[model samples]
Target: MIRLIWTLSAHTRYYLRRYMPTNRLLDEIRRRRNLKWGIPAMLLAVPYLLIASICTNALDQGAPGWLHLVVLWSVWNAMKLIIMGPVSLLLLVRARIAEAVARRGGRRDSDAGESVNHAGAEPLLHR
Candidate 1:
């Protein structure tokens, strides 16, 4: 009984977090109003456009009807997946390369007496 209650509470919390409009999240997006985040966000509009067109057509009671809309929605989502996969992979690879370079440079700095002492005493610079 306790486990079930906990599980329900966890699910409720997850849904709220997923759907709620948090100011912090919006503020961060506003702050990062740059190409890095902007391009992908723009790409996301494709799905919304597909949804809008389908809904508009369906409401008109067109010949092909709901089935056509469903197929289009599926295709739109699939295209989004295909388009985003490569872009995301490229971005991830770039980040990894940057991290590797930073680490390599950081090691050189650490070699120049930036390391903490093994002894209980504070680092030489800190003291």
Candidate 2:
């Protein structure tokens, strides 16, 4: 069952990737997602959520049933963008800290009272 779902998703992605006109822009966004550009990308969710809200209003006004699909797709994309913002921020922070550490002679911090054992070279605490 899960395999079937996975295969279906793969095929759907294949077709979408092949036909989507904005594939290049999406690829660029994905490539730079962990950079400063990602923070502003979170704002893209606002438009999606607005679209979903508009479609939902239309549905309430007796729009066609198929409008639900647009609402669903908009909400889902908004959620993905919203989530990616904070995650990318965290990743950026970690990358910056690693770069800073590397610049500072790349010495890993160790407690002053810790001793390394010869057998495993693992640290042993004084306590």
Candidate 3:
């Protein structure tokens, strides 16, 4: 029961975080506003869920001997999802931070170059 509740809570939080406005902020900061990382993630997740479902169904029944092989596979995939959820979120956050730092550094470098140019320019009166 506790495990079920934790699973539900984690899933809920994952969905909620995806829809939050902060996701947009992160995307903008990361310069990946146009990149769709979700596509591949969903592609991988769909096959995983389908295989898991089939394996679970087979296990619940007295299936052919060879089908038993999938029991562990399904369980492993389920556990992978449980663990990947937080790791993916952390990766997204890290990517966003890296993007922001790169952007800031670029801007600072440009500003410094401009300042140097201005200081090197001779005054009209001096000319």
Top candidate, metric lDDT: 2
Which regions of candidate 3 are displaced past 4 Å?
Answer: 1-61, 122-127
Give one digit per residue, the lDDT tens place, for model 1 in 1-127: 9999999999988886576443223233333222145345445546656775677667677645556666566565546544554555566567778889999999887765434444354765777
In the order shown, what is each candidate's alpha-carbon RMSD? 11.9, 9.4, 11.7
For candidate 3, give the lDDT.
Answer: 0.62
Per-prediction TM-score to the true structure, in the order listed: 0.40, 0.64, 0.49
Give me the displacement of residue 11 in model 3, in angstroms.
Answer: 35
lDDT of all the models against the reference?
0.57, 0.72, 0.62
Index of the highest-TM-score prediction: 2
Q: For candidate 3, what's the RMSD?
A: 11.7
Stretches of candidate 2 exceeding 4 Å from the true structure: 1-6, 15-34, 106-127
- Minimum summed lDDT over a 10-residue window in model 2 is located at 106-115
Model 3, poorest ten-residue lDDT window? 34-43
**Residue pair clashes in candidate 1:** none
* Sequence-dependent TM-score of model 1: 0.40
- Which scores greater on TM-score, model 2 or model 3? 2
Tell me how far the alpha carbon of residue 93 in candidate 3 is from the true structure, in angstroms, after superposition: 1.0
lDDT of 2 by residue, 1-127 (tens): 9999999999999987777533433444555433666667778889989999999999999999999999998887788777766766776788878788886643443432233454456554643
